[model samples]
Target chain A: MAASTIMKKTGAALVAPVGWLAALIDPPLRALQKATGLNGMAAFFLAPNMAIFGIFVLFPLVINFAYSMTGGSALFLSGRTYVGAEQYERLLTCENYLDKRSCVEDLFWNAAGNTALFVLFQVALMTVVAMITALILNRELRARGFWRAVFFFPVLLSPVVVGLIWRWILQRQGLLNYLLHQFGIDQVLWLTDRFWAFAAAIMVSVWAHMGFYALILLAGLQAIPKDLYEAAEMDGTRPARVFWRITLPLLMPNLIVVIVLALIRAVQIFDEVYVLTGGGPGTSTMFLTQYIYEIGFAQLIRNPGLAAAASILMGAVLVVLTLLQLAASRRNQNAGAAK
Target chain B: MGRITLDHIAKAYGSVEVLNDINLKIDDGELVVFVGPSGCGKSTLLRLIAGLDQPTAGDIRIDGAIVNRVPAADRGLAMVFQSYALYPHMTVRRNMAFGLENSHMPRKEIEARITEAARMLEIEAYLDRRPGQLSGGQRQRVAIGRAIVRNPTAFLLDEPLSNLDAELRVTMRAELASLHARLKTTMIYVTHDQVEAMTLADRIVVLRGGRIEQVDTPLNLFNKPENLFVAGFIGAPNMNFFPGQVEETLPDGLSVSFLDGQKTPVKAATNSGAAMGAVTLGVRPQHLHLAQDGEPQIPVQVRLVEALGAETVVHATASGGERVLAVLPGQPAIAKGDRIALSYRRDLLHAFDGDGMRLAGN
Candidate 1:
């Protein structure tokens, strides 16, 4: 019996290795087994990623949609009253709560206009400055690495830190005023004035985000073959013409990516506006995200349904814009490839 | 219609010198080719002449003007790169007109030049197509057409045919030769292939280790190579060398005794100051022949015979432990380990001294 047990154990060890060897020799059968085994294996491998995505992305999105149609305290998960589409209707139609005056202007529409203006100015300014900086850096210059580090350092700073730093710099009695004092100029209230506050916010956004776009543009510039420039040189083509005819066209695909990413990030402007003005010295810096926060958490009367509805509407707009940009990019890539 | 001159051109990057004192004058409408191994600075020299690079010391004159500080665009020259370097985004018409457009040439003149260049290159049908839509040879033709449209004083080509297949390279080589004949412009071509240099060059400049080895016509480079490096590099199945010593100085020639103690008369002038101790006898493979009985012959043990239809190459070892190759007409039936008598014409022999310098006179 002992001898038989030893033989059985040895056979068991040989079987495990032989099975592995057989799997390698016969790929089709092994693939079938792998396909059959994927549910268990995938669950083991992807459980953590799925859990994080579900908690952070899918769960929040579903909860927001559900909460938009219900009337409840965000703190109290249970005992919620279903209000159907009333929250959406109130969000779109109710102007009394939106504006305190007898004036017929809607606060949601105003906030959206502000967000649109902010996105337009910030994205355009950032893209142009970044591309120009990248072009300058791509040239044969002294201390290129040092310049790249200087430009890219701002991208590493947190958005809140950037906002706080710029707030102090732009304040009436702060660094700008100090510099102006040396130059014998008058002090200006940068944050209190609506135009100045908007301009300052846009400038700070461009400053913080310009480095990332510049780095991407720099990569694109570097990818252009040196021989192309040499060929241009041999052709008697001027430097300006080379930039227009070769460099700019070749850098289009990268520029599109930078513009799209900047647009998306710019539309989601929240932290800077929050830290800089807390939605204002008046309503000058009250952006869409701050509006949502105010309705949901900070208002005298907490309107969960209105805030949820606002959040859903904003999310839909963002999704549509992103998809439109992606589709345009895809078409451009196809056209480029076809050529 | 311009002659280019490079007067003592040298290039150095930091401490390491890449090109050292290169001096050559290319005559008007002549095709000069720079041929060398990789990293031999042949391309660097071409770039210097094309004004793509500035020399660290020396001047490059085009049409009697020093273009040392001139940019490549203002130098009145066009270059075709190895990669063709055509704009992938533009149609052929646009690519050819790009330089003219940059110069602010009028629309009508640009179109006229483009049409003329396209017709000359036989690429009229491909004018509307982008470079990516063309074949390798077609793209090469377009690159040439782009240069042709400019009507530059000189043309610079850097291994333009190296990217093509063997058959295409030959076809393009003939095309390039015809192009040069028709254009009649000073063209400096750079290549590492000796066959390309031999077929295309009016005068070939052979470079080695950042220095010029020899500058000569193709036949001259083949027949009268100045040094051991040029002799070995320029020919197929290179010249063979056998070790020998001067036996005695004759009235008309020198009698050299081979390693096997056989004495043969070599018609080479001996330097009076040179020692007659050791020498090397060089002979081309085609000069060696199979000998009959009662002729001056050297016995060889045939190791391998290669039949190449037109000519047979016999690889053998001589009795004195010297390896030799003999090229004979047609196929010769010979097997390994067979003893054969190889003979050669006495006057065809070339004698070199110990330092690889060719002996004078005959």
Candidate 2:
């Protein structure tokens, strides 16, 4: 830890000379800006940041779409032949959409089905739990800072680290079984059993991400004016009644944000689940992200076409979610405008 | 039924005390306004009365029952906050219904109460609209309507009209006064606006530094402020003070003059044993005007003249840089840098003793 911290300091120190060089050029840049109008100068200064964003983010996005349309597994688009909608057809044409076994690429359907279930369970349970935690943290409770840090601590951990920590406690000879044995109960296979493994994955995902959403909701809670609660109290509003009538409705906007973000995160979950159960005891714990990874890299036959198509499908799902988020925020804005 | 008595109520947050020995008896069906500068604990006092906050040491009684330990919801009071605090998501209709719903009132009676309140507020047309859709004044009325549906024993309004614009504030003030007259329910209002206090309250409690400076009718507070702070606070175009020390004691009255050796008061009276020493004499701006040839006057050079339509305010400095304001009737054709002589009317003078307390005999 100390060596890493020293390295970070060195890294920052190494950038100072470059910063000085930029400062030297700043005067000439300002001189040029003075000769030009504001829009020209603004675009001139924005060039570097925009170039970086375009290269890193937008360029890859376009390339991913390009890859989805190509047939063979060529790294470069020039070496690959165009398949038009062939890969998309294989994905969309399922004999029985409900049952993945009858689909042309059955594993993709299975992963997609499992992910839908995961998202529904995870988002519902996580939101309720996070909101409750936020409400409690927002109050003047004892050890408030400590409790807040405790809840948000998991979010700071690497996903692999979080998975490793939970894995030790849930394994067959893990701490959980030992505790159950001490309580005079039989040891249950937590990760080996299909139902339990799926449940465990959902539980771990919720535990890891709940704090982040709770922190957001906490901010929303604190932003509410204190006088409202005082007024509600004077109106003879019962505590539970106040929560239902005032707190819940006023917090709906933030809750929408939490749901959208949590849904997106759940759709992309890979690292923690992969480390925890390796997409098994069967395909029960496999997620759509893992399915994409398996096809793109892990399979004996590397089918980049199929993997890219699956990812494109996932991207479409994300777009719909983002649109839902946009609709929700617009509604929230209308509510705010009324206020 | 809504008589409230705060018995030696004192509040302390940790080691810092905000209110000290506050003893007040608010009568049933009366409107009392607590007026003070910011951070004078007026809102804290209101919250204590509403049972929203507990006093560190004392008891609060409503209708002669000790209610210090009773929860806020059991206090049978409604408060209209400065922010209005209306539930934003609920319709105006539902916002008014929330409190009644908590009480398990029959739905028909709740509807009737809501309808009557909405009609009274002239907000019946907007009942279906959420608070976010209403204008500021409209939202304030809905806040009041929500309070009215409960029909609680009393109402606590903490600067309810302060959020409105100037024109709306004046009308809302009249509306609130008429609301009090119609309901005749006991109310305790808190505001820093002395004008709001003077106009809306039957009696005004002037507070300074966590203690009551004086409490009286509006005219009494205006005409006879009890101290330097109240005198300065209770008037617009605020009262001018001339710091003077007692130079002579006569059988009829004592004589005092401005600290700058330019003028002496026509008459200064001291009630029997009241000590005569360093004193500050206060006169409202309206009492000072263009001097007659023979009358006593303080010479001042004008710094600025504000001709505010019906009246003119001459902001000038007396001898030795003492600032004074003279409000003259109608338009006074005075220019900046014009030297002026101002007369002091003996009857309109107020005197504060060395320690800032009002001298009883004036």
Candidate 3:
């Protein structure tokens, strides 16, 4: 009995340090050690993601706000001035600015309206087309993989490349005009006209982005259970009615996701319009992004202060829209759970 | 009301045939159950009847009119699925009214039917609730309610109670039976559980590997099984069989020798030559009794005794080394390794041929 007791004591003594080591090495709590340790191993593990996010997102955001208060080039020692919201006042009310001819009343408000129009039309069109395509491709048709690939191939192409190709096709002597000429029709100016240029930008934006929305919507459609459809059939529900009652209601969550994503991407449209129209045709298609770029870089004398103010305002609007979307999504999930 | 007939029905996927030459007649207002083990084509047959699938060769007729080409929505039949399949997004009232609304029924009539169905299912309080808000049993009741509101000519239930708990299944079974009595609509129910088939079916169709093994009333099938498969499948604990051959013949009976070489006379109708061949003797465990001594007694060494309160089961080996079970009433004072004699009533004995067909009785 004495030997057994000694052995038990020795086992406990051996296990104590090992348990301590295990607790130190545990995944969840090891983070605390990294935070408190002098060696900084935890920071080393977290560096890559943090560095990328800081450089691409956080750094620019901070610099934009700081630059909004200084009047000079973003380059260091380029003659700075502490403007104190003066840049925003100038952009909002200045009448003699060289780019002010592009504005109807106020440059900022006109660009905002143009961006809203572009966002509304493109997002609505892309969502409808994407949902319809996803529904059709999700059926049990022959060569389904081939059809999905055909519909989704556009998303793989670079937006710049897509814009350039469509630019060539929409020009006066391009493929569209050539086709029209085959019918002995007069050439229609697609880019020079203000309405036509706006229409062209919206069309190119949808064409280049519809595939991404379609892929997401297709996944959501496939996630719906097939048994529900069979149950609808057994209830003597017609095909159209089943779609409206069962399919549409169940797909609302996915539809909201598609709408929000498309809206976000649509409002930020730059590359395609830049390559195709260059925000021309008397500023009809000049969006907020182009307007900011012209103020910051395109003009001979870069106005970093004004560009920074515009960027901050656009960021604020985007944040508000995103927060509203998140709140709506949360409410929808809660309602679904409550049922 | 409609009478459904399946004539020489066969189903195949490419080269693999799943159901072959199936023929059945479901009379109007009768509840027929298609029961089998898993992957036995029971669900496929139900789908065929509901027009969810078309048979490869045979024709399906409803009320003497061929409906092989009719789509599911035009078949005028309702189905209750095993998963309930109530629309998760719609309230109970909306789910029941959806079909009527699709058919362009007046809004007032749709509301009335929905109210009636909700009242019938005792879910009036839940008309505004979605299926996700209800329990499994309540969801199933809502599914049934959805079907009732359609007022179809027939109802197809595909293992609709398999999702319920055991106690709820029993209660739902009674509820479904009463519902059938009230509606008197032709119902085709499918299940893998024989208890459900025996209790709920007016007639049970036993299927095995895409073929119909037997179709008969539950009691008749229990008492007179056609073959070894039916006999082995229909009973609980299963009927026990011992290998044997005819040894001699008396004026009134034939003496059969057990594998242990003991001969006992059984009243059998087979001639001596016919009975002299290879045979098997079957007796239910409940038929055997512990005897002190008898002319037909066989000595068995008890290996295990299970004393269930109402009955006792003795697992033992005969002197000839054949395993046997004897079920008796009350507890028997038998222990492991104890020797006992077991006997059965002569008329309770069953004889089968080597192929597992029942032999004629005298």
Order the candidate numbers by TM-score, best to worst. 2, 1, 3
Q: Give the winner by lDDT.
A: 2
* Cα lDDT of model 3 by residue, A31-148, tens digit: 7666778457667678899999999999988878888888876544246778888777766664454555544336566677789999989898999999999999999999999999
Q: Which stretches of candidate 3 lie above 4 Å from their native place? A: A1-56, A91-107, A176-188, A335-339, B239-292, B295-356, B360-362
Worst 10-residue lDDT window, candidate 3 chain B: B267-276
Q: Relative to the true structure, how large is the alpha-carbon lDDT of every model? A: 0.85, 0.88, 0.84
Worst 10 residues of 1 chain B by lDDT: B268-277
Tens-digit per-residue lDDT, B164-194, candidate 3: 9999999999999999999899999999988
TM-score of every candidate's chain A: 0.82, 0.88, 0.81
Kindly list the per-residue Cα lDDT of model 1 for residues B1-362, writing each as its tens digit: 77999888899989989899888888999999999889999999989888888899988999889999998889999999999999888999989998888889999999999999899889999999999899999999999999988899989999999999999999999999999999898899999999999999999999987889899999888777777777777767878788888888877668888859888888766554443767788778888999977767889999999889999999999988899889999877777788999998887777777887666323
Instruction: Considering the two chains of model 1, state its CAPRI-style docking category.
Output: medium
* Candidate with the larger DockQ of 2 and 3: 2
> Which ranges of candidate 1 are over 4 A from the true structure?
A1-51, A72-77, A93-105, A328-339, B237-267, B272-355, B360-362
Give the fraction of reference interface contacts each candidate recovers. Answer: 0.80, 0.82, 0.76
**Can you tell me which runs of candidate 2 are displaced by over 4 Å?**
A1-86, A92-95, A178-186, B259-272
Which candidate order results from sorting by DockQ in descending order?
Answer: 2, 1, 3
